[model samples]
Target: MTPPILTVRDLVVTFGTREGVLTAVNGVSFDLYLGEVLGLVGESGSGKSVTGLAILGLIDPPGQIARGSITLDGAELIGKPEEELRALRGKRLAMIFQDPMTTLNPVLRIDTQMIEAIQAHERVSGKAARERARQALARVGIPSPEERLDAYPHQFSGGMRQRVAIAIALLHRPAVLVADEPTTALDVTIQAQILAEVQSLAAETGTAMLWITHDLSVIAGFADRIAVMYAGRIVETGSVVDVLETPIHPYTAGLIGSVPSRNKRGVPLAQIPGMTPSLAKLPPGCPFSPRCPRATVTCRTTMPAETPFAGARMARCHHPLTGEPLAA
Candidate 1:
């Protein structure tokens, strides 16, 4: 079998604070294959963003990838030299940050920025880089790409700016595209458009994509597979059909139940009972034990080893949910 385009093994990420070390990602592991989209879904503070950054080698000073291996195309990235990682970043892997305005330069015209990105990876001349930039913007469905290229970021609407950011990310045709809440700030219509465009682009380019979002609906619409995260760990993973159809983990079930449409008419929205555990003060066993209805003494006293539910479906729960699954 061909190896996956990207593989993460026992990945652990931690942050250094005045209080102490806080674990953000605890032994998270998954794989992304060529031409597939993987959704990392969870609520806020679930360490979804931290996992994306760790894979991209973008964790800043206070946060670090303390353990585990991030291998892309069979090369370890965790401890590579800065220069080597830098070379890999824009050329082989790219990220679409949550805030597009922050990602694009407010002072520089789109053409200048995009050209610089292309030129940075390849020894292309000024005119050639400009053409490449224009093509990328056009590819992302930006209207009047040439005209938009000369405009500064502030001159564009928020949605347009995000398109530009995504365009930059795709400029190098990176093998892996990590999108961290790429649609969070956009209106539903624009969000839908961007999601469709990204999905199509990934298919055409055979790009392995890690789409990090809190919206399970979005994952249902776009991802081939879904990995449900809770308290810095992946609690369940499977094909979109299996995970959404038969969510074995209680937390996964809760998240699905909380979706507005899942609740009955005239009823309060179904909700998971407790807040996410603090990274600095996580409970003794399963980080999600406090909120999980199925949690038991085994869940509170010792972490449940991952158990298989079905093909490629794994859930970490001693007493998992069982029955008809909720609809997305």
Candidate 2:
């Protein structure tokens, strides 16, 4: 079997706050294969975005990747020097933020930024790199790419700018791409287009992508697999069909229930009972126990280890759900 393009094991990210050390991502693990999109789904503060930053070595001061392994193409990245990680970031790995402005410079023209991005990793001529930049823009469905490249980031609308960001992230055809809710802020129509573009591009370029989002519906048609995260940990993971159709974790079921469905018309939209638990003070047992409907005494006192079910399916729940998924 071909090895995964990216592997993350027991990833723990922490920050030192006035209240003390807070673990944003606790013992999260997953794998990303070439051309596969893994949807990391969870609500705000679930640490999905933090996981992406940790993988990219972008966690700033007070924030650190505490004890774990992040490997890209079999090379360990967890303890590598900043210089080494920087060298690999754009060439072997890349990231796209939720906001295009986070990846773009307001003052720079799109062409200049794209050309510079290409040049930063490869020793290509200016004209050659510029042409590549134009091609990338076109690949993302940006019409008049040649002319659009000459404009500044401000000149482009939100959706168009996000396409530019996606174009830049794919410029190197990196082995892995971590997208942290890149489409969350766009309208439904634009979000669908962006999702389609990204899905097709990943297939075309053979780039393994970690797409982070809280929307189950958004991930349903976009990802090959889903990793349901809660309270800084992955509660369940499996193929999109299996996980969505038969989620074993209560948290996963709750998230699915929250999504609007045609079958649920006129029924009150289901909702998870409690708010996300605080990372600074997670429960001693399952981090999600407080919010989990199926949690028991064991679930409230002892953390459940990853329990494997049939064929690559796993969930961190003592009382895993069986049969059909929640009827949302």
Cα lDDT of model 1 overall? Answer: 0.88
Report the number of the highest-lDDT candidate.
Answer: 2
lDDT of each prediction vs. the true structure? 0.88, 0.89
As for candidate 2, its clashing pairs are: none
Expressed as tens digits, the lDDT of each residue in 58-176 for candidate 2 is 99989998889988889999889889989898888899999875668999999999999899888999999999999999999999999998999988889999999999999998889
TM-score of 1: 0.96
TM-scores for all candidates: the values are 0.96, 0.96
Question: What's the residue-level lDDT of 70 in candidate 2?
Answer: 87
lDDT by residue (1-328, candidate 1, tens digit) is 7889999999999899987998899999999998889999999999999999998899998999989999999999999999999999988899998887687878989999999888888998999999988889898888899998889999888889899988888887889999999999888899999999988887887889999999998889789999999988999998998888788888888988888773477898889997988888888998888887777898898987666664667788877776332222
Worst 10-residue lDDT window for candidate 1 reads: 319-328
Per-candidate alpha-carbon RMSD to the true structure = 3.1, 3.1
Off by over 4 Å in 2: 323-328
